[model samples]
Target: MQRRRLLPLLLAAALPLLGGPVAHAQAGRPIKLVVPYPPGGPLDAIARILAEKVQPTLGTVIVENRPGAGGNLGADAVAKAAPDGHSIVMGAVATHAINPWLYAKLPYDPVRDFAPITLVARVPNVLVLNVETADKLQIRSVADLVSYARKNPGRLNYGSGGNGSAGHLAGEMFKAQAKVSLVHIPYAGAAPAQLGLLGGQVDLNFDNLAAAAANIRAGKLKALAVTTAQRSAAMPELPTLAESGLPGLVVDTWFGLFAPARTPAESVQQLNAAFTAALNAPDVRERLAKFLAEPAPTSPAQFGDFVKAELAKYEKVVKASGVKLD
Candidate 1:
């Protein structure tokens, strides 16, 4: 009788050990989804949505904002964190592609220090002008804007989130490709940059579609063109910058999930599956559309290759723009 009782106790104690990887991941610790930008921005909003959607499959997921150094601070933290898959960063174009070339002495290697899990989404930047300013300048399209800028010769100024941000790079690319001169103004974040545009402090802005969608809808801002090769599904009426006379002006920003380089493949795969499922959920897709973002989940290997291509593409852009940060 004692032996039977002890056997039951032993089996009960051993059950947790035999529960397998998924069970272990669930019971061990909560997963941390680190956002490298401040809260209330599109990145933070997306991260929070993902955390909520994937929590069912991921057990317990939480978002932590560690905004600084143009998203490098949070990315570096993940790169150096324990490779146990409990911690991951929501890596963006700024962190992985632009920062590598922009910063002279980056604390971490974008390709070497992290493992790409799955790309969350891709959002194009829109060339948005203040509604009142657009009306005043009669800038109805990219062509009109370019002509005006050429005629004004540095009279028109554009605002961006920061120096090396996607918006800034887009403005530089536009200046080069369109052969126009517009003074560049860098703000603390996209929100402030948009504020500058709305308040007439800046004439125009190159902002993420998701960040500017609401304002565009409300007529506070006029989106002249999307900085992508193709038009966005959420706003199909908007034309692409290429179609608007600048052929090679594509600046679509992407966000993805990344873990430490040494994180187990199994763990990475599990994470990819969970995030992919969450991204594909009908409700999640609807929410992403509200922000003008498109779901673009990819396998780990595919995502890795995509990141490489992005880095290579941005290398040329950064070099041509002559942008570097100390």
Candidate 2:
């Protein structure tokens, strides 16, 4: 009789141990989705969109902004969270791939400390030249740009957000792969970098297509190519650098969902199903299209493999650049 009476109490305590979010979910607790950036960013907007989309299946998903240390703070919080589905992070390329090399001390192992749910989206970075500069230099395509850089050596310059930023690294990769010499100009952020390119202070820039779209449309910027494995749906007409000349010059500013490592496989699958379903929704697709983000939902295993590959790829790029941050 005593054993039977203790059974309920024991099970209740064991529930969390058995499954993190699974138990909390049964208890009507909402899942917490951490966005490691500012509130107005694309990641935050996507988190809110997916959260609402998945609420029908996963209950409430609270988006907590824990921005700091270039996304390390929020990712670490999720990495250290109980191996439950209740807490997950919208981790990106910086937090997963670049930070491992950029930051001397990362708070968590991006691969070992987290369980990948699914890749949410990939925002392709594009190579663009100032309209006047492109015309002046007679540079219209990647081939033209590379040829000019090769002939002119350090006469050409590209602007980026800062040292070790996506644009900077992309430029470094391009220089190495193309065997060209181009000076790098680091600006305060992407906006400043765009401004520099527009003002012709810089010859070119690798910026997100969405951010550069308005200028490109207004004829102020000439987009050469995108840096994605495939052409971005946002601008299918624009060729990828890989297609243009550099076959392996693929770079994407991507983000995905991740839970604490050792999370129950069942819970992970549940979360994946919910999120993937949300991503597949037509309405969600239309909304993400507006942001110029390409939704890419993958199985957990596939996402894990992709992350590992990205990590390995960036290791070489970061090491070659020799740029380190605290």
- Runs in model 2 deviating more than 4 A are 1-25
The most accurate candidate by TM-score is 2
What would the per-residue lDDT of candidate 2 be over residues 257-281, giving only the tens digit for each residue? 9999999897898899889989999
lDDT digits (tens) for residues 93-119 of candidate 1: 989999999999999999999999999
- Give the clashing pairs for model 2: none
Give the number of the best model, judged by lDDT: 2
Error of 1 at 228 (Å): 2.0
Report every candidate's CA lDDT: 0.89, 0.91
TM-score of each: 0.88, 0.94
Q: After superposition, how far is residue 70 of candidate 2 from its true place, in Å?
A: 1.2
